[model samples]
Target: MIDQYYNHSTVYQRRTQDFAKSRRISPASTRLYTGASMEPYDEELFREHDVKRGLRNADGSGVVAGLTRISDVHGYRKEDGKFIPDEGKLTICGYDIADLIDNAHAEDRFGYEELAYLLLTGALPRYDELESIGARIGGLRLLEDEYISEFPITTKSKSIMNVLQRAVLLLYAFDETPDDTSAPHEIDVALSLLARLPRIAAIAHITHEAETSGVRVVVPAPNASSSMAEAILEVLRGGPDFTHEEAMLLDVMLMLHAEHGGGNNSTFACRVLSSSATDAYSAYAAAIGSLKGPRHGGANSQVTRMHADIREHVEHWDDDDEVAAYLAKILRREAFDGSGLIYGMGHAIYTLSDPRAQICKRYARSLAQTKGKGEEFALIERIERLAPEVMRDVRGTTKPICANIDLYTGFIYNILGVPETLYTPLFAVARMAGWAAHRMEELYGAHRIIRPAYNSVMDDVTYVPIADRH
Candidate 1:
């Protein structure tokens, strides 16, 4: 079946190329096509129409779309039509995220699988239930021999995210009931994906490295580790050389990222697709594509690169004045990608703080010290401290800005020996739980197709025949 699909795709590509060669487009035609594009609308029209651009209210708060029992993200208070920044707090299934992680730490156990179960089921599992879910995930972790060997080798995509998306969409072909929308079946498919995506990402990363270096890469088979964090480290490193502290930190990272409400871009994309009652695979694939955007899941890698540039250009990491000057240059479109924006310095929902960032910083500080990177870590801390002040002086930003989770995620991954290519893919792996939970909610709870209205600004005009045109 895979071979047939590949052959058809090859033929289609050939026909498309042949058709392209048969056409001769003149420069005048190209100019005409470009000129036919729509012009930007006046900003006044948005005020006159009371349009909520980007689904956000005038106060920069997201317009409430729907309700869910999955999780809540709180970062501000509204009183008497005023927005007041507050310390951020995140809860998963009515449990404080800090408490959950702390309890897991006290018990010396990994918590991602437990969090996955809670996100899907909306309740904490018992002792037996936890063990059962872990065993189920372990059982589904290994891909079939053909699936593992054929897809990664044949497909030529260098991006791990693209390969992961392709692998997920293709898994539908192997499902016995790919179109099943039943709750039981959806849960099954979600669990299968949660177990398998890490392995798929690992293989894609290894394959790209091998192709580039011309070194033979030995893909590790799935292991029966006690936790998803351990399994990920083992498979990525091609052996069991990681320590207890590293695995525990990875587990905390996964738990922190597992869910961020249904309103996030990728989860919302999933909900939009699921509202149409599509199959689970299509909804999840769409979510993966959404997450691949730079504004969303790709920000961690950007932050890493931006910091590297800072380390290169800034001579004195300890000198606050020098760091602030470089940051001001970045805001003035003179340095570090010239976008005039810091990558990891702000959050849409959190104003004064992001609880996840706060928690990740604590753990990252310890890891940085252990790995002999305290200087680099302190440099990052200085950037976080100075970026807001620089933004205010240069960009005239009035509202409060805080360091988001991306500020520390890339640093943490580096400490864990993870490649930059896998940063966003690993985000997707943890986010699969959230995506699945929200997809199920949209399918079962919402039950209405999402169709938002768009006000058209173009005036109607009579169509002209080609011969009658100017």
Candidate 2:
């Protein structure tokens, strides 16, 4: 493993290995390079601006300001309790998210292949460009050079996020030219990965199913003819009847979540790592680790767990008052171990009900109606309609109380036969486009090492020797 790290990986611990032996040949240790180093800039300037309060305007506090936008494509502005991402800027790469939604409900839906081109290249593709991308992506799905199948594929009580994190490293291993960080090369790596990651995620699930069901699952490579949803359908619920509407619906989900700017925890991980001029593989692998945190990409699964906890207390969901009581009691910590939290009720960013959540909620209704899951839809619908009031009245929560994107996506994902464990892996699949674009932007546009300083808590300290301590 250490040899692998030394030879292949750009990890910190291994970078310093064989330090004494390598010093003679190292170009970085030369006197000329050392003498030419730039002067240290003032760290206080960042502290004066209060930049490191988690990038907030003050020490862990601020109203919304200064969030960066890479794609003005999905522009949103909150006004009077609603998100009005106007019809035009919502047009990503000349195609509207709304039109895709309309198409999903009506005819065959466009796959993420089209959106990948838009986000990575920053322009809408013609038919020829789209076809070329689709072909290229389909061809890149197999992990032939660095096959993950050789690794121990266990899934019993194991986190799928961890599995995905490992698989990203596998992608890094697959790249023959891992250290090529030039803009053109990195873009190709990112694009190749955009097409490959969904299949990687699907393989993790397939392995899990194989372990649990005691059946051999022959995971298929990505096919250009199949939409991502159709591929997932065949993997999870196998048959020839992978419907266009369902595949398109999932396409919409991926497109909607594709990008939300670089401030998000995972995308920010991408920015920071790539700022060091690290390879695209390491950058995205770092991002996968960040997304594994329960706070970032785990909310959709939390929404499912919250539903389970709610069911343990409130059996009857038809009564609006009863549902409200359950929500209030949970927020007040009278139920669910008196945990003073409702998992899917609010967001860190969006002040209004999340626009993505709103879109997903509408789609959830359609799925519920179509699949005769009206009861399931009604329960979350009551929570959606009432949770804000409960938060305001019971917990004295001043911050906005609204359904985040996680709230509604679970129901729709459940309809699509996805389990809770796979929820965040799917998130990685969707956010890959955004992560790739942000990392490349950091590399090409504003190329600075993303080193932030921490304010020292203990300004003065005395060291005690071991013998003198007692």
TM-score of each: 0.93, 0.80
- Regions of candidate 2 where Cα sits further than 4 Å from its true position: 1-52, 58-69, 72-96, 99-107, 145-157, 238-241, 337-339
* lDDT tens per residue, model 1, 1-470: 32454445455455445544556546445434334242234566788898998888998899899989999999888999999999999988899999889998999988898899899999988999999999999889889877866778765596888888889988998899999999999999999999999888887888889889998888667776558898888778887789998899999999988999888899999999999999999999999998998899999999999999999999999999999999999988899998888999998889999999999999989988888999999999999999999999988898899999999999999989999999999999999999999999888998899999988777899999999977
lDDT score, residue 87, model 1?
90
- The lDDT of model 1 is 0.88
Error of 2 at 355 (Å): 1.5
Q: In angstroms, how far off is 82's CA in candidate 2?
A: 18
True-vs-predicted CA distance for residue 335, candidate 2, Å: 2.5
Q: What is the lDDT, from 0 to 100, of the residue 178 in candidate 1?
A: 94
